[model samples]
Target: MTNEPIIPTRKLLLVCGCLLGLTALTVVAYYVDLGVFHTPVALGIAGVKAVLILLYFMQLRYSSGMTRAVIIVGLLWLGLLLAGTMDDALTRGWLNVGAP
Candidate 1:
């Protein structure tokens, strides 16, 4: 195994601070009411949070390119599956209330 330097405590604190700040931002964003863009904005913030966790908490930044590629592909595949499911759900006639 290669001799990799350990991450500094300060850096870890900084990342934690950033994650906390982003969490606060997400909470604030919820009450802002951007209408049609609300979901996209929330999703974008969540994506940033996920990346930070993946890179630092999961130590993916120090990993090989193949590992990163596999993760990206997996996330994309999951996204596609979710999107397809949402599409199908939206197209279905569930309640059968017939246009109130």
Candidate 2:
């Protein structure tokens, strides 16, 4: 008795196409300078790609609620770590400490 979810070929192909298109868009975004908006644009596109891959390739869409919860929690933890790192890096020069 197999418990695996069967995904349709058409849906998989569609997702593949979307991922490829997003990759191309990323390349295009890299060349065009948006100044301050560039980083946000790139990160946004990458986030979309990551979500698509997570849902489709990782089969998260077919996973149980508990499984999804775990994945969400893991992502939240990762975000927290990244936020902490960014905070430290950004605030490094705020207070001047003596160098010995």
Q: After TM-score superposition, what is the CA distance of residue 84 in candidate 2 from its true location, in Å?
A: 1.9
Kindly give the stretch of ten consecutive residues in candidate 1 with the minimal lDDT sum: 91-100
* RMSD (Å) per prediction: 3.7, 2.4
Per-residue lDDT for 65-92 in model 2, tens only?
9998998899999999999988887777
lDDT, model 1: 0.85
Show model 1 residue runs off by greater than 4 Å: 1-3, 91-100
| Candidate 2: worst-modelled 10 consecutive residues by lDDT | 91-100
lDDT of 2 at 35: 98
TM-score, prediction 1: 0.77
lDDT of 2 at 66: 95
Superposition TM-score, candidate 2 onto the true structure? 0.84
User: Model 2 misses residue 89 by how many Å?
Assistant: 2.6
